[model samples]
Target: TESSTAQWANEDCDTQKLPFVCRRAGSVSVPAECPHEAQKPGKDIIAPGFPIHGIPCEYMLAVDAKSLVHLEILALEANPNIDFLEIYEGTMGHNLLANLTGTISNPAIYITKSANVMRVN
Candidate 1:
């Protein structure tokens, strides 16, 4: 229903060819150290050894008590067969939020549903 009042629906990813944006190299600087836990906001989290062999890494993001954390995936590129990113609800991996693989066509956003803590692995 491609009309003035179209509703949102899921479609086949393999069939659709949507336009995307690409950033030029050297536009953004990669951080030197990857922290295991994060409390401050606006810190960019990059996969260990990105664009190459990405080693296994885990990170946690926590906000002040009662405040929720919002994670935004600005860019995600990975080998769907061998790479993945898992997000958890709290300080542990018991509650799975999202498991992402393959290349992301657009920016993805995830908000804390029940708490102010989030873990990424």
Candidate 2:
């Protein structure tokens, strides 16, 4: 049985082919709010509502255009599948520096290839 976007339905046993519906563009939009924006050399950024159930959030770190940004993962603990932290070099469209998930016991350091900006989400 077919249902609306906000609802689901179940149908009895039947042998039938269902036509697929396709869309050209996307519809859903998630509001990404970056509470932590840092420019310092050694800054610590904790995920919003960290160590607890985190809400949808974003974090952006920008440094001087000529100076590269270095990121160190001092500690990390999260569900690998559901929660993740993505590090990008320039913008979100640029090179992906690292895709971090799960818990990391040892400290990990990353230096951006580009010097302008780094995004964390």
Residue range 21-64, candidate 2, lDDT tens digits: 33323332222334543546675665544333366565566777
Q: How accurate is candidate 2 locally (lDDT)?
A: 0.63
Model 2, poorest ten-residue lDDT window?
1-10
TM-score of each: 0.71, 0.63
Report lDDT (Cα) of residue 12, candidate 2: 31
Clashes of each: 0, 0
Best model number under lDDT: 1
lDDT of 1: 0.73
